[model samples]
Target: MNIVRIPFSILLLLLTTSCQPKNKSDKPETPQIVKETVAPKVEISLEELQNYETAYFASGCFWCVEAIFESVKGVKEVFSGYSGGTEKDPTYEQVAYGRTHHAEAVEVYYDPGVISFTELVQVFFGSHDPTTLNRQGPDRGAQYRSIAFYKNEKQKKIIISYIAQLESKNIYGRPIVTEVSEFEIFYKAEEYHQDYEKRNPNNSYIRNVSIPRLNRFKKNFKSYLKEDSH
Candidate 1:
């Protein structure tokens, strides 16, 4: 239940803009968004989804995370949302402007038959830096921090084991700071936020930040990517 308070104005500015350039040397490469024909999302009935399971992750921005998970083979849908907080039905402005404690999160609905939750956990850590506390790239705030929310003790064990293995291998220079929390309610973001990266491919923030992060994930998880993504 601990929520870090960031200056409201600074939080608003960070949420609205592309990742701020840290320094001349640390700037992310702005890659051109390749115009590709993306396949439409396959509609799944409630009965079908009942056979599947959902996982929640908060890493950096939901826009970036949503795109990453959607590209995965078994992921039925990825919804941009807010979670890891006590707020009831938090709005984007409330989370972005520091009015709510919610972190930018994504609810990943996937078929366990195609991709296991363990593999999804790998993607979560591989796609984003878990070592940076309360920050991801250019975005800095408690709401941008890394969190893996588990719905049950089994899922919690998986997350704990993976983190331990990563730590044992010393994969990160610093300790992984991702919070492993029990699952709670996830308030979906505004309509405009859904499929944002795909719909607004030419947007400044999407072009500069979201696309690059996605491409990096695609490169590493080639086997996990959908055919159209490949």
Candidate 2:
């Protein structure tokens, strides 16, 4: 993430504060927070990104997972998609019915140079309640199920170690039921769903749940969050 400077925003805020003193509402009328500008990610060739790695997890709404992964420093992209199902290229509507066998998951594309797969797993554990089986918060059913889609033997070991560490530390009163499986199918979601939280911030679900989730994560992992993701 790269910071963006806009003098107009400062000008607008000054004008609003000085020009409209009549309405003395408790909440001040303020301009929206300006976000940082990031250059479009040049699509990485499969061979180049291989130096990094891929990981996946399903812990609730894809919007939340996508937002969480994007906060991690090493992560290149977090895609909202469906996986661990037999279906092929399932549509959002089809998956919503809970018949696709897919768990709404986020695929993390990250650079190993900036963060390790082990740390990514830690972020996964921190971002969502792993004890909730087949659910995260209020959302229920298989689509919102928790699962760790491991790409290889290394990821399996990393996931196992993290779970054991959490269990030994008594992190939660209940047992963790997150599924650990070898990755197979991954169906990219619809185009608009790529960055649901960032793209549709005004939508009811995105605004109420997704943004709050992202904000909480930002507070927790201030160091890991991408500089511009804030």
Candidate 3:
């Protein structure tokens, strides 16, 4: 069982043998090579998160929005947080004031091998209103504005095209005002709000708004649902 004596080159080969396609083109592409400049890390964990990608949205309360996307199958994880903010590591109360420019957002982690950025973009457009200027449902304020934080140029391009498509279809019957910008940082929500819906399903907000949003996403994207997923 002592595998330490085995050549490292063999281990390297085994690690790289299972790479998958990443872009729209069918051409064989190495994700590491293409994404290397896009916040790619020097080392990947044993969990195969190397294949995972992230996208952020700020349609409304992080609680409802986080619960919605977590039901998605290819989606690996959803973290409620603040994004597009001016403050550094702004707290729940600070962002609630809307003075920091931070919006209640969800940072979604997903396996790009199972889902494409375009598909994730589609999921985003479907889950929330891109037409809303600074509000979603009952949550009305600049802090509730819609945003799509892109980590790389590839993601930015996909978001742009998707917005264009929505505009052509008159999806929201107005210009898609979703903010698409380079992802700067994500400040995770308070511990109590991390998995608020799952842990506090009986809570008022979770029971009402969050639960409905979660159920809607599951029903609409049933095929993307996973076992013990969220």
Best by lDDT: 1
Error of 1 at 124 (Å): 0.3
Worst 10 residues of 3 by lDDT: 1-10
Stretches of candidate 1 above 4 Å error? Answer: 1-48
Sort every candidate by TM-score, greatest first.
Answer: 1, 2, 3
Per-model TM-score on C-alpha atoms: 0.81, 0.77, 0.74
Ranking by lDDT: 1, 2, 3
**Model 2 misplaced stretches (Cα beyond 4 Å):** 1-51
Q: Write the per-residue lDDT of candidate 2 for residues 1-230, one digit (tens) a residue.
A: 11111111122112211101122464544323222323333455777666667888888878778888987898977777899799888876666557589988888888988988877887777777788777676566778878887888988988887887777766765688889989997887766566656655666556566666667667767777788876
Better of 2 and 3 by TM-score: 2
Cα lDDT tens digits, model 3, 1-230, are: 00011111122212221111133474533332221122322323637655577788877778778777777778877788898977898876667655588888888888877877777777677766667688665566788888988888988888887777677666566687888878888898766666666666555555556566666666555566677643
Q: Which ten residues in a row have the lowest lDDT in candidate 2?
A: 1-10
CA lDDT scores, all candidates in order: 0.79, 0.70, 0.67
Across 65-137, the per-residue lDDT of candidate 1 in tens digits comes to 9999999999988889999889898876567655578899999999998999988998888888888888887
